[model samples]
Target: MTLNASLLKQGAACGQEGVPPPPLLLSLLDSSHHILCVSHVSPDGDAVGSLLALGSILRAQGKRPTLALQDEVTSEFQFMPGAEKIIGPAEVAHSYDLIVCLDTSSIDRIGTVYIPEIHNQIPLVVIDHHVTNTLFGTDNWVDTGCAATCQMLVRLADALGVPLSEEIAFSLLTGLVTDTLCFRTANTDTNVLQAALRLVNAGASLEFVVRNTLDSRSLGLVRLWGVGLANVQMEEGIIWATLNAESRQRSGVEPHQSDGLANFLVTVREADISATFAQRFANNGQELIECSFRAKPGFNVSQVAYSFGGGGHPPAAGCTVSGSLQEVSARVVAALRELRRQSVDGDSG
Candidate 1:
């Protein structure tokens, strides 16, 4: 179960065929005895999956890995293996030989799970698939072409000479299915499917993953969507909705449940871009808006997200802004319209 870093330098399948992890990434894994693995705040399946999968992989390497997240795993993804064991920032130890950030675009994206003064003192490794990644880790292996960070970890397991345990396969496949919307995303290429296939062959159940994640939601979310969709607005091929704190309380929905309302808006036939602005309170309890966005295959939302100090893929991205829900939604919708205008004009040009 103990693998050598030299194998990574030899260019093994650890990173898939085209996306190899840097040897230093593997060296840290080979060298570090205790590791901390974390994903983003308000984690989606990809974030939680990558975090859990890394913990499983590190354990296989005979290393102690602490899995941490800034937010609780939503009900939809709690079915995934090991989701219950993930820790919060307060539970994290003050010392570790290494920290591996997974599926997070930037250091802050991991929330307080990464204490800059403490965990930052350790050698950090970043493994992510988001183009907006800041390369914050001391050793970074960012594969933007990989559909999900879980997909990248598959390659990492191979490179590390570890077999895919059922726990690993189940965790990774959850990310692939949710991030790609059951193989329907624009980024779902043959390689992604092939990785999924291998995971299934290794004993992960595709039906189980799909049923629990993509096909399931809490009734609270359904109620929140009702409130969100009722306020939907459209302008110049842009669609948006606002879920203010009042509406959220009336609907009895958690902030995370109110998300994906943006993704739901883009399904409108007349819409080319979509956004949902949901209200949230920071650790200091100041109200802010969390903007989630989605665009059709040919359009790009990442640019807009990056412009707002956030980052994600072209078809999906987001940012956090400070203002009333109404104010933030209005400002963001204006930007979405401009992005749509340019995307349309560029297509015709």
Candidate 2:
């Protein structure tokens, strides 16, 4: 069933009160038959949740949907009902009626899974919640005001007249909880809570999702954080840390285990901005530093990340730089300091 304008507007405004969905988004979905859905590389909770939720919703509507991701679904999220259905790039077909890209800011974020040469003929739909989104789709529904892409999908489900099933509700709620840190982020509003409440009422276990996502972490991850904290630094209201490959090895954790260190560093009482620089090797064996940034309320780190060719929300963002950890850290820390300086000066002005 096609969503009327009123329903589209209501669904789009699910989180932001009066905002509306793109005029053509609902129509695009209505017209499509087979769809291929993909999220970003290094799939996070929001990415996986939105991808699986949308896939489930489409299946309920009698459409064939293929869910693809460039990275593996980390063990933390594998318990979700449809996690096993996700396929890698090697498994993707060359044809689809449409391509729905979820939670990704730019086309490149899909990695090699999206082949422009093969998939270019398909209508590309971009659904995301990143403030730094590049608007790189034939049809784009980017709602930066929404806390997570899954929040946007909650609206989409409403538009499609699909009631949230138990699986869909659980997946969507996982995204909302992890992205908002259980409604503790600054962007958490009545609408976010309302969406979450709906999911809870639909049988999503808030306690279960919390226990699996935010409240749970491996001992190795805790050790990684300890190593990261040992080298932490703070200057001009900015806190920073570095996690080298050796530190990852010493902690007996994978590279992504250091992901939460920046978030932890941002909790420092005196700091408004936090950053983590991690040493990694590229496919070509070249050394690189992955930079993750997080800002407290009223500060935006997305622009800084955008300047380095990465994208994200105001409160959290990231970019990868090709350089030694020390060099990249020094350079990025200076840039973050400048960003903090500008924001502080602008606030006082």
Candidate 3:
């Protein structure tokens, strides 16, 4: 089914009523000469994929696009076309016609890579699928029910009549597969499948995307998982693990190695939620902890993440707590207990 002009108008009207805008968004493209595309720190596939795909889309429309990351890109994604073009916040300065932040729900989550000086000087556009999105853009497009930002971008392309090129389709498909865990997540719907079909017709190769993304794990990552798994602990049916900077360095593990390990702890028979606490020793002597959380269906990890200054989808979300790892872990456990109590109270009430 082709998206008609009236349907597009209705979508824009509905967006004014607070619905997230369609994925194939072109409103920002009008007269914007230079655009900055960004993703959050420790970016998963969806975050990076959305930025790259959208950057490509912007480039195709004759806009100069600079894909920026608040932090470093994972080794796994370094080979993606246009990935090498990502510039640091300091290097770019106040040079963009518009700054688009993707997949990140909040500004703090951008970490040290995106300095306040840079963000304060630019017009911001936020695009995301996280339920905890704060609408922190001069223009915001957030679809909590959407499986991934890439999925939203595909719809945006369709709405704006941008024919999906092979590269754009492949990049978007990578985001969909990575964010949905190859469609294992409950967010996949008929529309999502139809979007995938369109992308395939546009020349996306599922086999190539999966091979490059899922099957590209390194031996260091495998060993890092072994260490993390060994540290797994169970508390009241919740499985948790802590990976300190020392252990990570000794294992020669990079940040990417720890990406999906926390979700794997859900394999425990009694586990309802799984969490991982990763601490980085700072040279400046401030404590910072990265907390990754994942819950089984029916759990709202987004709420859990928000309580501690983070956000994402219900089943998958995370936050970084500014304290010692032990302190953050304790707070997370307490929050989970409170969440369970609230659940029980709601059920009984």
**Evaluated with lDDT, which candidate comes out highest?**
2
Cα lDDT tens digits for candidate 3, 1-349: 1224433343334223225454333565665778877888787788888888988887777788888786667778776777787877576656677777888888777666556665566667667777787665666676666788898898767665678999899889989988887877887887678878888899999888888887778787777788788878877757888888777777777644575787688767788888888887567977777788887776777898898888888888887788887888888977876675676578789
Ranking by TM-score, best first?
Answer: 2, 1, 3
TM, every model:
0.93, 0.94, 0.89
Instruction: Summarize candidate 1's per-residue lDDT along 63-172 as a digit string, tens digits.
Output: 99999998898778887778899999889999998888898888888898888877667888878888788777776677878899999999999999999989899999
CA lDDT scores, all candidates in order: 0.84, 0.86, 0.75
lDDT of 2 by residue, 172-193 (tens): 9999998898899998988899
Poorly placed runs, candidate 3 (over 4 Å): 1-25, 112-121
- Model 1 CA lDDT for position 301: 94
lDDT of 3 at 77: 79
